[model samples]
Target: MEFDMVAAALRQDAADVATYARVLTVTLADVLPPGSVTVEYERSLGDRLKGREGHPSRIVVRLGERTLSLTGGHRPVAEVHHEVRGVVLSRDQVSLDVWVQALARELVAQAEADARAAEALRRLVTGA
Candidate 1:
């Protein structure tokens, strides 16, 4: 599914589009097959010493020949990088809304063909 499709679904299902998109990104990362999505954490020395798992700072999703990379902090802005095959297509600073929407769209597209992904999305949207 494209971002537009995901947006339409969210408009119909979610009370808050931005929050749902962010949650969907995390859900996709957790549920997708290993090696399909990679998450990076920004752990401080104190966190490492305490054996605490830091929050995700970066997520990279690879679908077929395209890759979408999102890097974010505590702010509502994120750095997004997209590549097709091995060529860089776009790299820009986008709002958190834009970032999560892109990620959700990729997950929706994956769900269209993958049962596991579809199940995850269904469960998420229905809260079942």
Candidate 2:
């Protein structure tokens, strides 16, 4: 993920919106599975502007039966929500925490996989 890309996407000016959208599209392409990421932006509502005063943006990622959503504006609390239906799961906060932990574990697993692949390639080149 590029800091410039994220920074650009978080910019405030109208002229910057296209640049930001391009950056966001590229960034999402890098992290998201094929055909799984959706990005959208909308003008600030009057009520929202009374307190926040900026455009609202959203990024949604769908992975089979699970969906992860992230929404943000010029506000402090950027909302994040996740839902996993079609599975036997508890409808409680504990389940939500468990899902969060599972996602973290999956990220760690991917990192480990990348490390192992890199080591193997290094060993092959060095004949180690």
Candidate 3:
């Protein structure tokens, strides 16, 4: 998707307009190494807020934190270890820069790692 569209999504008001799931379901599956890095689950810190009562239990779209979960994908790489990877979205406390940066960084890193792993796996299989 275009960056403008993403920025627009961030501008939305989860408390009033965006859905509980919509805010948290902005997915970029292929951003990481081919199935190398995965979203295991998401945890919400929005509970500490007040007006968010009207929102769903998850009213944010924070990647790697709320909207996405990390599973055992990048681990197999054994060459690169990335922990901070996801967008950060909330009802009123949203950080588009942080989220975008995190996602981009992870996406690039994972893409690179996946490329490297592909060669590594190929070598292993071919015994070359």
Candidate 4:
């Protein structure tokens, strides 16, 4: 019964995260140029949520070829789980307004790096 109760709570959390993800996506959409970025939300479902198994619900932020996945599930404690490419960071909170600002900065940095690399390649190719 206790497990069931906790699972139910977690499921609710996942749904809440989904709602937050949608709104966050909208805000991100406004900041990122069309087609430059994408946000995805995943929901938890079915009968069981074993440990951290089911609360995988989260939002994915993709900027060009780089990606960041953020989640707030059990153990997140209003804080969030954040993953940048291969790096996983725990005890983070997506609830903070700073999260979005950080994301924007990182995305912009990635775009700038890509642009610089492309320009360098072009110059090399043209022998300029």
Among all candidates shown, the one with the greatest lDDT:
1
lDDT of each: 0.61, 0.40, 0.33, 0.43
Q: Write one digit per residue (lDDT tens) for candidate 3, span 37-126.
A: 322223346643543333223222232333322122222111122235543333222243444334344343444556653343233224
Candidate 4 lDDT tens digits, 1-128: 12233223223333355554553344333434455433333335542353233433655555544444555555332333344665655445554334444544444454355665334323322434
> In model 3, what is the error at residue 100, expressed in angstroms?
1.4
lDDT score for candidate 3 against the true structure:
0.33
Off by over 4 Å in 1: 1-26, 29-31
Could you tell me the lDDT of residue 96 within candidate 4?
Answer: 36
User: How does model 1 fare in lDDT?
Assistant: 0.61
Candidate 1 lDDT, tens digit per residue, 10-44?
54553333343355466554446668666677788
Alpha carbon lDDT of residue 25, candidate 3? Answer: 41
Point out the higher-scoring one by TM-score: 3 or 4.
4
* Residue 10 Cα positional deviation in candidate 2, in Å, after optimal superposition: 15
Worst 10 residues of 3 by lDDT: 70-79
Q: Tell me the tens digit of each residue's lDDT in model 2 across 10-126.
A: 332122333333433553233334676566666568746677534436655455444544444443212234445645233222332333343333323333456553343233224
Which candidate should be chosen as best, given TM-score against the real structure?
Answer: 1
Q: If ranked by TM-score, best first, what sequence of candidates would result?
A: 1, 2, 4, 3
Give candidate 4's TM-score. Answer: 0.34
